[model samples]
Target: MVAPPDNDVLRASALHFQHHDGSPALQGVSLGVREGEVLAVTGPRGSGKTSLLRCLAGLDRPQRGEVWFDGVAVHTLGALARARLRRHRFGWIDPVPVLVPELTVWENAALPLMLRGTGRRRARRAALEWLERLDVDGRARSRPHELRHSERQRVCIARALTVVPSVLFADEPTAPLHRAESAQVLRTLTAAARSHGVTVVLACAGPRRAGLADRTVTLLDGRRVRTLHLPPVAGPAGPAEGAEPAGSAGTEGRPACSLSA
Candidate 1:
């Protein structure tokens, strides 16, 4: 088992999970994400990236192993406790932006704060600020169905940022957008996270997208196969320029391929 790293905001140790039909989805996966840093989990389809993300975010529990967030053992929390933690501390952006059909863009962005009992006006103000930052404020009065897919994704990002949660789990958040739109949204998201010191764990399918992060962890068939560490640069989003080559290691004694740029 890999031990959680010191000063890590989130850590997963030897996580093992199974699908509803008892098919193994994750096998002894371990990783750590530091506070205020972005870590991208990248892999091909059916490689367990989503499962690992869900387990780390407390949305699902691993059948074996441990998940820790800021020193708290997430696996031990009850359903209500886990729900409360998710509500108050963590933020999530899924592959698809799921929004309330009746709510306006700003209203949808402010939903989390409203659910937590913040006054509607205050929530709206905060939500608008994030929307503006994400370049979606012009559409604040529009309903979800009225916005384009890319715009909706931006609004979803605004919603996640409204609370400025300690950590954000984004699972292929830009998958529905075109290349240019994806890059734009990623730039905004990473800049916002850096400015606010929000830790981020982004799961994606390709290295090009994963390059936006400070580090990348690659998974193959439910196990970590390699780790890439990129040098610090001005922007936290987009590809790193002149980045050091990535390091690799075998999984279960199998030969690992290089992730070098």
Candidate 2:
């Protein structure tokens, strides 16, 4: 297989996937994410946004197509190798925050670092730093069950950021949040990513959410229909004309984020 360019952090070519019941999800989809760029995948429900994100992140393999990451063919990696890649090179945030019930919020956030063999004291310090960045530091000692949905999501973001993964895959990360909370979380996410030069592939169900991305790829009926490149400076004019509204972007009802890592 031909390799992607050196500047491309992740590349997907002619991807196709089907559901367990034999329903089509992604059909001949292809895209590339540049280093440190935030690319948003948007489409109406069942438009294959989640499936596409999964394939790119190596959480799910497509029946046809190739996924290249950092010069490696991700689709060809064994399960264990893929898992290691995810743990070491990628960060992920889901629509719903899934934390370890027994662990405190900080502990949950530190889990990734701990798994990587970082010392508990150092991991806790790093996790707290991220929690503060996400504005969830006050809840550090609290358990996931004790926090609100938004707070839980913030902690999840903190967890993902603690490792400072090279690429972050966020799927409907703000679905459970209010408009203001969503904006705040997105701001934190994007800001941290920019500062760290983390490439982000965010699957957003709403146009408002996609507004935060540098560019958006729209899918229809499991196929990529169009790609919209947003201006570097967003003005008051609001979503460029012809941009697809969130309503038109199909939601596949799949789990918001990848749990593989």
Candidate 3:
């Protein structure tokens, strides 16, 4: 077996995955994330960004290839083991917010830490801190149903950061927010991760929202690429005279892709 690098917090090699109906999601993709680094995986829809995040986060195992985390072989771990690892060491934020209806916002944010045996009071304290950071602390006592969709997403982002997990997998985390709110929230998330020494693997539909990452890796049809030229946005009258035009271009993956400072 090929060993992971000593400095890499997460690494994947020759990853291959397919859906139940034989649709491909990842194809021989490989990459590495250094400790405390924020890496953005950018691509258009159906480019395997989310699939790669799932495999690296242990939410799904690749049919072929290896995943290593801090020198441990994550791909070889059983489902139960993976669950435990995720609960204690990893955080995740989805595009949508999901919270327990019966629980208050703070309770939902604190759920993971509480599940890990943290004292209720301590967990609440931690949860409240993150909520405030995400600008959702005022709704701490409100149940999930009481909050707006954007508010709920903020709470979810707070929840994911409360534990300060070693690695956080965020898939389109700001999809529900407006552009202004998205920018503010992303700044908070990335700033917090850097301060806490947390590694982040952020998946996005395009590069527009990936500027906060230390480095970015683009994916195309489940494969890594050197560049992904997105088509210009179409205005009401159609493409502007000097618009770059609608299309994309990319190259196959390169070697030793690193997150440079």
Candidate 4:
């Protein structure tokens, strides 16, 4: 497992990336995830959620503004530099999902480490350990086609984390799973990340699979709409000693701003 970062592993300020028609895909999105923090990005399809995650992972460079990871300005780096950073520090789970159907579960999970210079035998061994932690070790030699869809997804995740990245960028990390399995996956992800002090920026739609994150934020028409409302802290005077304490003044997960489309 990777050690905790002494500082922020991922931070971005006012990032703007556009689509082919000159339409904005993401606009003025600013958010920060500290090491060991899990933040969920939720929005409708094309609400800039995937784009935002891609920009942060350096898969797609933003047209304007900058993205920084672990104090390194990713937007300023060249292709090779970005790739190196991604390999060493970032684990990006694709939105559509990708896995080699011919490779066994162990091979698929260990491929990342092998590509990073771990010998195949050693990679396979370490990969089995990851599968054990994810509770799928019994499927070690099973190929992708032999497993169920949810199992494949979890294997892909294990592959992503095989290298113990400092920051994991998970786009649609949870998909097509029953509630029980989804919660199990989320529990595993956060617990594993916290142990290694890895920050997880997972993008998904819906209520975020029950017990998934410490905070959740929304994106609308290409910008972050503060989706968390913290209550006014109690005054030292103790809210004038009585008062109903404001009933609905402090709901938890509503957006601070709204966008027209």
On lDDT, the candidate that comes out on top is: 3
**Best TM-score goes to which candidate?**
3
Candidate 4 local lDDT, 146-231, one digit each (tens): 88888888887888888888889888776756778878887887788888877889887765452478787777668776542322
Instruction: Give model 4's TM-score versus the native structure.
Output: 0.82
lDDT head-to-head 2 vs 3, winner = 3
Give a tens-digit lDDT track for model 3, residues 112-141: 999989999999999999999999999999
lDDT tens digits, residue span 223-259, model 1: 7865433223345674366543332222232223434
TM-score of 3: 0.89
lDDT of 2 by residue, 1-261 (tens): 668766788998899999889999988888889999999888666778888988888999899999999999999998999999999999988889999999999999999999999999999999999999999999999989999988999999999999999999999988888999889889989989999999999998767788888988887677776443222233497545544333332333232321110
Q: Model 2, stretches more than 4 Å misplaced?
A: 227-261
TM-score of each: 0.85, 0.86, 0.89, 0.82
Q: How accurate is candidate 3 locally (lDDT)?
A: 0.89
| Cα error, candidate 2, residue 215 (Å) | 1.1
Candidate 2 lDDT score relative to the true structure: 0.85
C-alpha lDDT values of all predictions? 0.86, 0.85, 0.89, 0.77
Clashes of each: 0, 7, 0, 0
